[model samples]
Target: MHKSDYIVKYLANSTSDYVTSAQLGDFLSSSTRTVLRYIREIQAESNEHGFEIISNKGQGYRLIIRDKAAFQNYLSNSLAEHEKSDLNKLECQIARQLLLTDYIKLDDLAQQFNYSRSSISRITSAVASIFEGYNLELESKAHQGFSVQGSEINIRHCINNLIFNSFTMYQTARMLQVDDLDWNSFKKAATDIVKSRGLNFKQELLIQFMKYCYIAVNRIRNKRYVNFEQIKDLEFDIVSDESLTLMLELIQLICPEFEKTTESQWELYYLALAWEQSIYPVEKLHDPNPERIKFFLDIVEKAVENIKNYYGIDFTKDHQFLKDLAEHISICYWKYLLNVESENLYLDEVRSKYPTAYYYSVEIAACINESTKTKIPDDELSLITLHFAAKIERENRKQIKTIILCSTEFGITELLKSRLNKQYGDIDVIGICTCDNKVQLCHDNADFYISADQIEQSELNGKPILQLSPFLDEEDCHLLDEFIARLNTTVPLQSICEPNHFYILNKPAKKAHLLNYLCDYLLQEGRITEKEKADIFAREALVPTAIAPHVAMPHCIIQGSSFLVFAVLPKSIIWDQTRINLIILGCFHEGDNQIKNLLKQLYTVISNKQQVDKIIGCKSYDEFIKVMNDFVGEELC
Candidate 1:
């Protein structure tokens, strides 16, 4: 069934109350725009049938069936399959062919797919950027047809990803049905190794190995072997000759029919490198590439130091965690340097479910990016976050590590620390750091920072500053109590924006026109693309963006830099039966860990009638920024 089938079935079953677009979008995991568009399409098609979707202002949508038999028949026909996407057969065939062939003429693609040249061209454009995240380009030559351009290893990685995204490694092997190859033995070799190993290999890593082996086997059959002569000459060592021999043994056991050529031996070494990167711990010292491990470990140490400086969490003493994290980064960072792109399927779930660890990972990623001058994919970022999340959960500290930045005068800081120690068992006061000795703070392993003296907020980093009198007055004690009470509230990750990115609109316009106009700036800035913009609108159709009266939040998954664009529409245009005066356009890169926190802060502001009114009253970007800072804290844009 098509995506629109979801809306139709949903509306058909809603008999009691009006279903809101937001409700439908949430159920479908879609945007308001997509839901609305689906509803329109479903309704237009249902008009020919016996049912029609009724859309009301306050009440969401309801199904009014004119002919029960006809509507039931229609539902039966559509609901036979579950979550079966209505993909274009022509497009699928063309996409698969394009990935396989080195180059193919547009007309040839059209003939092969049994479609017009224009139709084939359009379909190709859709999947054109499939390899872009892999640091490869799909260049379309005007006369010579389309071909991929990049490092060969990266190309293979991207191709395998594209194939495995739709089909599994074993399934693709079955479908390909290459002649005279014992595919089952190859599969058995992987299963046997995993069985001999342990349960540690159960979590999709086996499938990754299977995928890599299958791709390598298939490519080698076509006489395309990885050229690794120059790669071994490089300083970065990946695996030992023993590991390569083990891989070659497996290969020989599986495909004894193939020739024992020098090229096949090199392929064995290449495959062995994959195994080393997969991280199998040896009984003693197993890392063949100590230089690689040391390099990434140094980077990880730098990241840990930065994390301490920024978030005030010190992991330097955690030698075991440091080693594990560095080894993982060696694999992740090496893949990056090799121009390989991969998907971490666990990224979104980790970001949403494990917010704290994910943020910690983000900080580490920031340090890595700064240290190397590279933008790692969100997928890799997710992998790093996964590691940290696992480590943090394993550590499982009971108390919140906190530090006090109070005056040394009269030892009042000592008094405050004593009081905290006596009253709050959950809050651990590690030490005190004065402004002059604040350099010692990074080593304290304190994430929650508090100040007693009235120091300038600008002097310290953008750490959460709760200023109190050093004298420890009654009001000061009360403030401390309140701050301690709200310690469980998470510090939100916010979108940073320049003052110019914020706009004050003097004239009101329709939502469509306004969204386009606002997103156009992002497009020009290379923050978003036309395809991503379409996704935003589709999301809007699924769920109305307007959160409250005169306020709406429209956002989309963007490329490159993530940003939030704010607009104050003083004229107040009608949206979803209410006039919308405030628009917060959140353009985020996929797998951003901050989206949940950002929405929480934004909804807090929108739900308040007084705050909405105050924002509507603003006449300029400066005024809007001030109001936002007041409502959502100074960090939010």
Candidate 2:
């Protein structure tokens, strides 16, 4: 894998986790300074997506991706733009050379590219600088040669940064280099570490091992040489202070078998460090309840199948490191589910043992069951209407002091004020005022103002202004109650006894036809006229009533209509290429107070999938009606 690819994978996996600089340095056998550089590059690349690589005083570095899709989109756009930049063209060639080779020597790269050693150094330095800024260190060990060190997360960040910043021509040309990176070598090393450590290994340790191998191989491919003094300074405490002597001994043992060059010495040191880091206590898998284990096993099997189907990446191969990872995860999951005592049950431990596996496991659990399931009340309309009245009344009560304004100075203002006070006795009118003059003192003291005429002169912005002209009639109060009901009430149950009642459809394929059919049904049933349907259509055009996926509830109140009507469509249909399967067509008659209760109940029933599916699956209309009656209850007519 390319250095950048390894970095991207690391950061993408370590959500809300910290990675220390020393840990990164040891993994890559590089200096902490170099790791810092890579982090800066990553931060710059992820800048637009709010990709922040935060560094705490004591902690090392972390990749915070607020918007995943936005970041990906930004990268795509950046890549397109980078292709046309001169700086990007040069960087591509540098990356290409680093990728294509097995072990790159700075001198060799300069010779091949016909650039001076100094020029090659500058290019490598520029690339290395990118890693440094992101808290990623690019270091070279005496035996390991060179490697990128830092937070694995930041390393992943560097890859994305590089990919997005690099030229398109370089991307296509770099394919050969990508192939030569020997991703299998790192995978093998990771698998071996897991096997040697047993199921007890922390997921983070496995991740660290994989990252180490990835960086080592890339360094060799890049032919980026690290000086011996730099390798000696690496702070690796995995091997005790005395064990450092053992590492030297091990390196000596391995070095003679290879070409014994300076590069070979470095490679041996890297191998020795890998061996030391691989040592850990093996965890024995506890025999969990067979039934519980099987349940988790089935889930894992299905997940594996889905992964194969969706991504086409087979994990069944012998060399597949993630295969063992999957097995370990299943064991942990079984232990967690059955409440069995196990050493590897904690999420942190699971993360350390199988980072990727832990992530997928959580996703599976979330998909199986949501965190919350709140059911709305059955008498939705009445409940909602009550809730609306309570809310509005509460707000109105909060407006204690008010000034009544009138354009025509008659007893009309006092008469309306008396009625308002009778209904809402808490309201205190400071005095009667006129819109013809500015009353600054009253404006400051009063919470709201009652007016009869249009008053454009107002210094107060959010202060309540009640217009009495529009609200004088009894019909207007009913309208206010209905509007309040819609806001306050939960969705109501469909009144199955009402022939012209509306039902919300949940299926996507049948939504459009259902809507059209309901429109025609209302007209034919004499519940609505063509002109009213046209009016409803115009309202729908202004603001669609389709609230959720596969469901649309359309309604409009017209004058002189007596009873409400409903039409139900269960199957989904396409509307503007968007499938809406469920629809509830409600036609409310003038002065109908029960519409709120009906709507509330319908919303409650529709919200419950079990209830909705049961209603939709009925073989006969009577069976469907029976299910509706049972759900809404026979007590509610």
Query: Which candidate should be chosen as best, given lDDT against the real structure?
Result: 1
Candidate 1 residues lying further than 4 Å off, grouped into runs, are 2-86, 129-136, 149-177, 180-211, 221-237, 246-266, 273-295, 306-321, 327-346, 349-380, 386-499, 503-637
Query: For residues 233-327, what per-residue lDDT tens digits would candidate 1 score against the true structure?
Result: 44565557677767877776655655658766567766776665553544322333568767667878887775565344567888788888878
Where is the poorest 10-residue window by lDDT in model 2? 372-381
TM-score of 2: 0.26
List candidate 2 segments past 4 Å from native: 1-513, 560-570, 575-578, 635-637
lDDT of 2 by residue, 1-637 (tens): 3333335446667654787755554444333433453554465456666567777757767777788887576556555653345443465456544433334677766887778888877777655554544445446556443456654334433443344233342342244234344445445554564576454566566544444344434444454432233334322222235334544443333222223456644544444444444444434233334543444345445644543442232333422333333344444432222112221112222222222232233223322222111111111212222322333344445336777777666587777777666765455777776655565543457766667667765534465565656345775454333332233333233332363353554544333355566678767877678887876664443233443334455666555443443334455554322334455555655445554355445555554557666755655546656786666544232
